[model samples]
Target: MSSDNWTEQDVPDQRGRVAIVTGANTGLGFETARTLAARGAKVVLAVRDAGKGKQAAARIAGDVTVQTLDLTSLDSVRSAAAELREAHPRIDLLINNAGVMYTPKRTTADGFELQFGTNHLGHFALTGLLLDRLLPVPGSRVVTVSSTGHRIRAAIHFDDLQWERAYSRTGAYGQSKLANLMFTYALQRRLARHSTTVATAAHPGVSNTELIRNTPAPLRLPVTWLAPLLTQKPEMGALPTLRAATDPAANGGDYYGPGGMGELRGTPKRVASSPASHDEAVQERLWTVSEELTGVTFPVE
Candidate 1:
């Protein structure tokens, strides 16, 4: 397979590997979990709904289990992490593939902006809690799924991180996605010393998935009109993430996405993010703030 055109078929064997895929019940997360399990990985569907997770597991053909995880609640996050720690002594892949997009203004159980809480903070705490399991394992990776939206109306918003005053759905979603990339960079930097587990990020481009159910009416019109040109199916969308998780050439802090025009759709390949996503100071600041918010500290460094 060409490095520039990697596909699911190119995913190496996953036998004996234990992978935890958040939101594995549907969309990109589901596709990602299914592919990994099919490749002989012992996959855990870390979903919000245990019933839906079991339903999804029933459809896959390999070692698959379900774990309930609600990203909006810190209590649930901690509970799920504890359960996962007990079940899996080591984790080969931790895919933070769950997220919300363009959601209405709302707060999480912890009173943080919904998108930011679920998309970044939840995953941050989970990774920190589980870092020890991956540290000793060679080739272990933490793959967080970011988005092209990270570049649109995205900022750290340190002044009012929770969107207390006002909120733009798109802006909040963008900030969350940008934070995902920054988290990966910051974590990878810390993991560099360990030299075993690495953190990577990926985007699905614009794939046709249920994640778009919350698109505001105005944006929905354009997306619907250009759906043919802008969107690919969920299977294609899962490729970038799969590549980022499994590619032997992949390095810490590398990002993967569609290799096509405007990065809207195409084969999976190494991709670049906005300059804002690469700001080291911002990455460190976000990491610090995330730790403060989640109350979970990484064992790294």
Candidate 2:
């Protein structure tokens, strides 16, 4: 358990490390990448838009590069992994930070729910494909960003994974975020044998980011009015993830989030997740389903 004041200044030196952060074009991902790069890590801004990615890299003051990665497309994920593996044979950190929030009922290019496909499945395949590179590097970490939304009407909904019967944007978004936590737990258990690599999870407590673009109109005004009091800046929100990615004391399967009330808007610290997120059965089942859906298998047992 970290203290209630674990700010970015507490992050240890990251010189000689290599980090890949998805969706690094803006928001929390950009802050995470920028902070790590500032500390001397070679950071890759893996995003879907090359122009935006290059623009983001230009804003950072360290060795930052851009790579194309569209999580909605498995083909793109594979290509990105191959490119990353060739460029960085040993990855010290892989931050699964890309995600879509509450959007209208939609499916990915591969016909899966957009949120689940991109947030969970895409990252699942990418991690499996790139696991080999991290395995040889001691202390390597794969930090997946989940969300507080996971506790809001979240369930695996195995039978209706695609929400074909009915779709509530909130429900689908929660499911995807919950999947992120489950994936972290399951991956950590599998990677336990290697002792070289670890899996962790983090959440930014209600940060002011572009992720809320799809919020219902009714709640938009109230949210905007309360933003100053309810939301933290993106840089502050990135603390938990940065800590999870670089904290030497952070253990596999550990979850980091804001230390403030309701795990929102404060410094980073170890935090507890919803009870539903701790179900081993659901985690295992989701893992199997993800493997089948993505056609990607882990190197671990």
Candidate 3:
């Protein structure tokens, strides 16, 4: 396998594997689900809208199902997990690929900042709730998709986690993405003893996806102009995630993303995250806070 130019063809056979991908209705998640299903995995599109999810599943020619999941609400997350657990006694993959980017300031049903709640906390809780299903399965993995946006104005912001004092869409997004990596590392540590299930993270870099719908007005024109040069298609964007989820060599705590200039776009490869994302102290603190906020605890702990 060419590590530097790894592509979807590099994915190994996934026969009989049960894979769940959040927000699988379109873009990166859709591409990820499509490739995994093509490789013979039983793909479940866990999306917010059941109708859209079914539509997407129908378009993919493989064994696929739809599970309604709205990450903004803890109730919905738990409900979806329960349903999934009942249907799948064992899960081979859980991809936390659903997320909101640079949205206007708002709170989720549980009252956390929209981006943080939906992007990091929602996946954190879901992973904890369904971790038991992956624990016993050999070679099972939990792959969370993060982004390069994690570096811009990113921090734990322990003092104002929800941005009650002030708000910047970019800052909130950064915090959420950074938390994704932190959660991956922290979860990997807890799963270290099990040796069967691993936790990893990946970023799509800059992809031309619906996620950019909320781009601030000022940057819209420039972003549109640079899109062709800086952004990759969703198919290419999903590669880093595919590699992290199924690559034979992908291990716990590994982070994968584009190998091109500034990791904006190109082939998927092993990549490094920001220094701040590696802070174990912050990671543990965030974990504790997440447990407190979501009231969900990991069985691995």
Candidate 4:
């Protein structure tokens, strides 16, 4: 299948596979889970709100279950991982899809910036905790969802990662998204030896999702006005992630995004990230700091 024409219809059979998708209550996450479940995967909606998770599950067909997961809290992440480990034994796909966009200055339960803590650290810990199960399962994949925002004024603020000195909502979001890509690259290198598991990434490309609620007013107005014309629907936005998770041709370290101009919206295809995201030194440093912050380590070397 050509990259420019990939769509959900191209996703292969996933019978007997188990996929855990975070923040599956609404928007792109929900759509991703729905599509996977429809294709015969046992889907677990790991969400912060059990009620919402159940509601989301009810709307989907096939084997669908909900698990409580609060990424802002490390305790919640640990508990969710334990529950998942006991239930599935082996996860075929772990989609790190939950995220927070531009938000007012805030900290996670661990005092880290909300965007970095929840979007990157939370998934970091969850993946590390569950990686053992994935290692032995051939073709198992860890798909982390990043964003084009990583290319827009984004850098890993090694010194003030918590944004203790100053804060810019968009910048923080970019850092978190960039961290997602860095995590994928670093993890793929570690998983190379195992060869059974792989790590990949995807970006929704300017989708109309609930994630936009926190956009700054100045930018929010124009985005709201042009959203219908410029943004893709949540289902379309989820195509990149779904393809990354299930595409037979996708490889470890490959990234999927919209193939349209500016990557705003189109069919899912292999895409390139910003040059900064490919920096090996920064990727390694972020991985080490993430280990220290999350206190979770994978079994892989």
lDDT of 3 by residue, 81-192 (tens): 9999999999999999999999999999999999999999999999999999999999999999999988999998999999999999999999999999999999999999
Please give the lDDT score for candidate 2: 0.94
lDDT by residue (204-262, candidate 4, tens digit) is 99999999999998998999999998899999999999999999888999999999999
- Among these predicted structures, which one has the highest lDDT? 3
Off by over 4 Å in 4: none
lDDT of 1 at 38: 88
lDDT of each: 0.94, 0.94, 0.96, 0.95
Candidate 1's TM-score reads 0.99
Model 2 per-residue lDDT tens digits across residues 1-301: 3466787777788899999999999999999999999899999999999999999999999999999999999999999999999999899999999999998889999999999999999999999999999998999999999999999999999999999999989999999999999999999999998656999999999999999888878888898999899999999999999999998899999999998888888998899999999999999999999999999999996
Q: What residue pairs clash in candidate 4, if any at all?
A: none
The alpha-carbon RMSD values of the candidates against the true structure, listed in the order shown, are: 0.8, 1.1, 0.6, 0.7
Task: Tell how far residue 47 is off in model 1, in angstroms.
Answer: 0.3
Badly placed stretches (over 4 Å) of model 3 are none
Write model 1 residue lDDT over 64-126, tens digit each, in one string: 999999999999999999999999999999999999999999999999999999999999999
- Candidates ranked by lDDT: 3, 4, 1, 2
Clashes of each: 0, 0, 0, 0
Candidate 4 is scored at a TM of 0.99
RMSD of 4: 0.7
Instruction: Report the C-alpha displacement of residue 228, candidate 1, in angstroms.
Output: 2.5
